[model samples]
Each structure stands twice: as C-alpha cells, then as structure tokens.
Target: MRQSEAIACLREKGYKQATLVLLFAAIDQLAWVAGDKETVGNEGFKAWVQQYMVEKNPELLSGATAADLWGARCGVLHTGVAESNDFRKGYARRILYASNYGQVGSNDPTVLTLSLEWLGSAFAAAIVWFLSDLEADPEKDTRAREKLSRMLVDQQP
Candidate 1:
C-alpha cells in the first residue's frame, strides 16, 4: 500500500519531498519484510543495500547511492530537512531544498547526488529481485515470508 502510494505521489505536483520520505519508509518496510529486525537502522539499510545491489545489479543501487539515501533519510526523518548538516535546535526548522533526490543523469559526476527517480527504479528492481529469490528458494528466504506473515497478522483485526 505505501509503496503504491509513494509511486503515485511521485506524479503529483509539490509532493516530491513527501513522496521521497514515503519511498525511504517503504525501503525500511522491505527490510522488515525480509526479517531484518536488527539492521533496519540507517547503517543497516546501507549494508543490505550494498549486498542487494551487488547480488542483483550494481549499476542500479551502488554503495555511494545508498549512503546518500541514508544521509537524506536521516536528515528528513530526524531534522525535517534534506541536508544532514542543515538542522539546529530551535523552535522551528528550515525546509529548504525539498527536492531531496535530484536527476542523477544531470548531476555532477564528481558529487554524489541522490536522485528520486533513480532510487525509485533501483528500489523497484530490488523488490523484483527479492521476489524472484523467494520463488527460487522458499526455504532460504523463509525469513522474509515469516516476517511478512507477522505483519499481516499484526494488521488483522
């Protein structure tokens, strides 16, 4: 549901920042579905991302990209901002540069910029790969299935 909503929000005007936040939350949900209770934090997300990208497609979600996503997630989730260093202890925080993810193609190659479309595509690809992995070996991937089952049960009446 959240993944679908996030994708949908992408097409809406002035909702890119909100959509990016949803996207990162969806990524965490994927980790939870994969039974990653321990490494679901900032660093853990990157570690799993590194492995997932290497195992599936390194061109899509590289380590540097994951790192930038983590930083952005930290900034948004913790400080209500996109840059990690732009937050301060005050009555209100600034919401500058809502576009957390920019265009990877046009971004400077020397600088690591987190692009919304690229990460979304990479995340979608990762999800497809994970589903294929489950179909290939249910036993090996039972952790994710079990976790998903738990989530479903928890959400039940």
Candidate 2:
C-alpha cells in the first residue's frame, strides 16, 4: 500500500524515471502476489507483464515487448541508465522516455521511445483491469489474497 501511495505521489510530481522504477517494481511484486509465489524470477516478471501490462495497454506499450520492458526496468532500477544486458545481448530493445506530454516514437528501429505520463497512466489502468480479472477467477483471487496478506505493513508505534 505504501508502494501504491509512493507511485501515486511520484506520478503526480512527474518524476519520469523514478516513477518508472516504482511502476516496474510494482509489476514485479504483483506478479508474485498474483501467482502466490515467494519470489518471481526474470521469466516470471516477463510472463506476468506480458499477460497483464502488455495485453491491457497494447496501445501505450506498442513496439515494446515484455523483454524490452524488463530490460528497461533492470537498467533504470539497477544502473540508473536505460541500457541493460538484455539490450546489449540483442534480446531486448533499448527504451527511451519522454516527459511533458510528449508522444511515443522512435528514431531507430531498435530503440523505442515512450511518454512517461502515458506509461504511468497505462500502468494504473492495467492494475485496475488486472484486479477486475482476478475477481472473476476464484483460484487466482484466493492466491492473490493469501500473498497480499503476508505483505509488509507500515506500523507506527
């Protein structure tokens, strides 16, 4: 819930890269929750994002594969850059971000550009959609609830 609050605040403040880092991390965390797994490896992250984020926000995440997003997430979160081993190894595309109501585009075929605001909004919408889908699937909902119940809480003395 704190992550959700932080993301909401970052999105409101228009911190492009910071917002993206949290967003990607949120997806990773949710993937584990949804699957009732203790941990989500790289493949799990890709699969979850592919099934949830990419499918729900195809228009916003167009031209960027789940692998590409994973690479971007690693780069942004680990190195504070936009290039990762996945990109360097030709397994994923490099991604650049734009802010201030910019459009998503790319000058090179291997490098995709996306709008920060749009990506944030798309991710938010995708969460809503994912939760709705989870509601219809009793098994997944039960798994999600179990995982969510174990999440860390911010307790005050």
lDDT of 2 by residue, 24-65 (tens): 889888888877568797887888888877887877775678
Off by over 4 Å in 1: 36-39, 53-63, 85-111, 152-157
* Worst lDDT 10-window in candidate 1: 89-98
Estimated TM-score for each candidate? 0.66, 0.89
**Residues 81-103, model 1: lDDT tens digits:** 65564223321222223234444
Who wins the TM-score comparison? 2
Pairs of colliding residues, candidate 2: none
> What's the CA error at residue 130 for candidate 1, in Å?
1.4
- Give me the overall lDDT of model 2: 0.82
lDDT of 1 at 13: 60
Per-prediction count of colliding residue pairs?
Answer: 0, 0
Q: What RMSD value applies to candidate 1?
A: 6.3
